[model samples]
Target: MADISLLYPKGKEVSTMTLTEESINDLSVDYIVESLTKDIYEKNSIKKILTNLTCDIDVINYRADVFEDILNFPELRDGLVELLKKLEDLRELEKFNKDGDASSLWQLINRLREIDGYVLCITMLKNILNTIPIKSQGLLDLKQTIEDIYNNGGFDILKKDIDETMAKAQNLKSVTIGVNLDSVLKPKNAGVISLNNFEITNSGILKNFMGFTGSKEELNSDEKVLSSHKLHPANPSLTRMKFGSAQQGANTNVHIDTSGSATGDDPLSQSLKKVVTDILKRMVKSIKATLQKYVNISGYSLVGLMPEIIFYIRFAELVDKMKEKNLPVCKPLAVPDDRVAYGEDIYNIKLAIKRTKGEEFDIIGNDITFDDEQRIYVMTGPNRGGKTTFTQAVGHCFLLAQAGIYVPATKFNYSPVDNIYTHFPADENDTVDLGRLGEESKRLSDIFKVATDKSLLLLNESLATTNVAEGVFIAKDVIKAMAYLGVRSVFNTHMHELAHHLDEYNSDDSYRSKVQSLVTGMKDGHRSFKCEIAPPQGVSYAKDIAEKYGVTYDQIKKNIDNR
Candidate 1:
């Protein structure tokens, strides 16, 4: 079991990062993950998988293949879901054995019920294995292993022991309790002195008065009479009580007792309780001896199936939702490590979420490419002009691609990054202790310290918390560092001046990455939200805003005349 993992390859160490809640929120990764897993899984558990995005391509592709196979076979997915639900209860069953407490008769009954659950789980798996046509090696291996276990003698032993034990457990019909009383009629002692006939639960006067002499073939399936030894108890607390004398049965003992008040608890009742407890202990010991081996081996393997089941169920649900909504989700081609990172028809997934929520707004998709000539983009645009949206979209696409899911784009190709680190602006409340600018600078420095050339950086208004002069000065150094490190990045900002030194940064032969300017376009006084490779538009955005608002001198005069 130690060598098994649904997410990781056998013998390969699982490597992942512990992203902070702030970082997760900053990138909207939580939003995307929750949206996909909504109504399918609890938010907290689903968020864990989203935060721990794998940097390993092999593991990512492996899970993707497994997800595809699940999506292809609806019956397989449904079967696995039912099995996983039953398997989820196994955790509670496992806890009973973790502590060495003695089992009560009542507790033993509950264990029998859980054992029934285990029996059902095995039968369900056997049926599923026989039905689903699994293609992925991960699922195929699981199927083969389950088949082997089913045919093993251990499985037969488990079935036989469960049947026999359950039969024995069920055969207790009724108990007759006898209590000794004092002068005040208080019970001084109590014991089960006799076992009675099985109680009839159903009440029908005609049936009680008359006996049916029907042929076996004429009786209904449920109408079969219980044999003497096969009689079952109505409840867990009731057990067969053996009496020493048949002469004790009389109406005289049913009269009220005039016994005196008892000074202490009944010793007879205490003795009887111990007797029942000891009997329960022996029964548990026998059952454990018969079933422990199969439980030890099969229980663990089933537990290990939990994560694999969750992964398939969540992804398959999202895939179905996307198909129903006609959203575009395409498989990405993972480019080699040394190749360029690029995506076409790239759109922000956040917009897709809005559309799913019944928003009628149109979502515009853009394209981005990161190659030797333009590895770092200094994106500048007016506020609300889609700079932040486009920057986050690029990061989301890469993260989706690496996770081996369909990207939001129609086509995407990416060199896998070691990790993604985001530096979206901190909230005023978050920066209050350190002051806004100070906190921003500290986060930027931390990002630089850990980031590598193979990492993808998503910077959204990072240094804009400070004054223009200071921000531009610091932004230049950060851009220079990014270029020197040769990492792929999108630094979207309101600092239009940051785009001025592109030629200077590109001229440095020591710098490994080229710098380029990107701007969100404005057409006919309306924000187009289309990002492209071009120089900054500068004050033209303010002029466009004025014209659109009718605040320009000529537009204002025309508005006044029309009014």
Candidate 2:
């Protein structure tokens, strides 16, 4: 079983359903994911979790419940967000431990640090989870997991042993190395003579120099303190060893190394790492097995949940903001396939986000459904009358609902589609080889090949690139194909004539679905942007547009007269 996942039920490791690229672009799905994960570390992974959709009802419910619990408990969301940062630290530690060139002792030290942090993460997880009244299967499983890892993992004993091991390994604060010179006064080799917890201050060096010179007075004073340790073995101006020091005169500053470390790959550093590793090897061995034993139980498995946990916590923040604006954000009821897919006061989420950002504008939400009576909609409206927007809104509803995020509606009762196929306007560049019509035809053929009754199809101004008569002819066949297949669809088009043949399309008893017409409404010659089931008002829409834009003959005459 998945130790705990905010995105799936137990034992379901992969998601069968996916939102196609066209569907993703048509509905601006990335905008939603990006908004949730913006300015966050590991944002790409969090986005992957949100986009990795599942078709199983159990999984959807499992995720939806987890989202609700996170939303309800502010403490849980805040605590998890902070914990993900520590998880990221553990990941960085793992990377450090994987360095091929680092000494074995170096890797061991970092491994200990990682497992040490891992222990704290689990303890923190248990403390936070235990305090929340989490009823969701996902969170409950997480709580149980923390308890299991804590109670059974000998954490108290482990922590004690780890601390002792770290102290033993890090007991020395400084090292004194003696470099052996070769024939021409060049340093040939180096080794550590002693390791000291006490600082070897410049005053002590000055005191030693005074003693070498037979001075009676003590040399210890604040003025003796200086900067970085010298690269030269001795001060050249003061002694024969300093004058004969490496190529540069003693007291010349050592140049900083380019490879992100002050020590660089100089002879001293190379030798120190080797000697230090050998020296510390015995001490780190005390906790080596302890760290290795819990590697599987305590590390990456819990780390895997970071992305999913972030997905919930980040979206929980968005949900809270949506609530502040009185925008409807409700957990959708994933109903049975036979039941109606219904939503009321449902506006596109893009508008809700804008409203939350303090953008003032009118957003009209419409009540919509796909039932036995209207299994598919043939939507027609005036130019820019929100046909495409509404079509995308429907796609967003289903996508967000299935992904276990709250839908943008007062109420949403939906039958989850296995997958959604979008037939939005393809790029002109994509149509270059086949021509627009041919390209569209091929895409439609591909959709039909895979789309089943359980799938949803969103067609936005499809086939409208060709002439009206040709577009209409092909569109009718497409709608008929959809009706015959019994799949739920919204075919929003500029070909108003396509909306007229729905009854004829429905009368064929061989087909399993009823097709109906939907139009974006108008009131007093102005666009209301509300959608409703109605016959295509082809001529009436033009008249309303003409009147609204002062383009009607009477209005033109009145304008002339006023001028």
What are the runs in model 1 whose C-alpha is more than 4 Å off?
36-41, 95-119, 170-275, 292-295, 298-300, 557-563
Model 2 steric clash pairs? 236-242, 236-243
> Which candidate should be chosen as best, given TM-score against the real structure?
2
lDDT per residue (tens digit) for residues 434-543 in model 1? 89778988988988898888888888998885478988888899999999998999999889888988988899899988999999989888889999999999999999
Worst 10 residues of 2 by lDDT: 250-259
Q: Candidate 2 lDDT, tens digit per residue, 1-563? A: 14567676668866565567777787787787666656555577765665556667888888899999988999988899889888877766666656788767666666666667777888889899988889999888878877887887477777776677666655645555544444554444444445566544543333443453465454333422222222234223222234232322211122212122223354445545665555444555665766675565446556778777877787788889989988888899897677359899888998888887899888888888889888899999888899888988888888888878898998889888878899988999999999999899999999999998888899999998647788888999999999899899989998888988877798999887789999998899888998989898989988987888989999999989999
Residue 361 error for model 2, in Å?
0.9
Where is model 2 more than 4 Å wrong at Cα? 39-41, 183-186, 198-268, 289-296, 557-563
Report lDDT per candidate.
Answer: 0.69, 0.75
TM-score of every model versus the real structure: 0.79, 0.86
What lDDT does candidate 1 reach at residue 509? Answer: 91
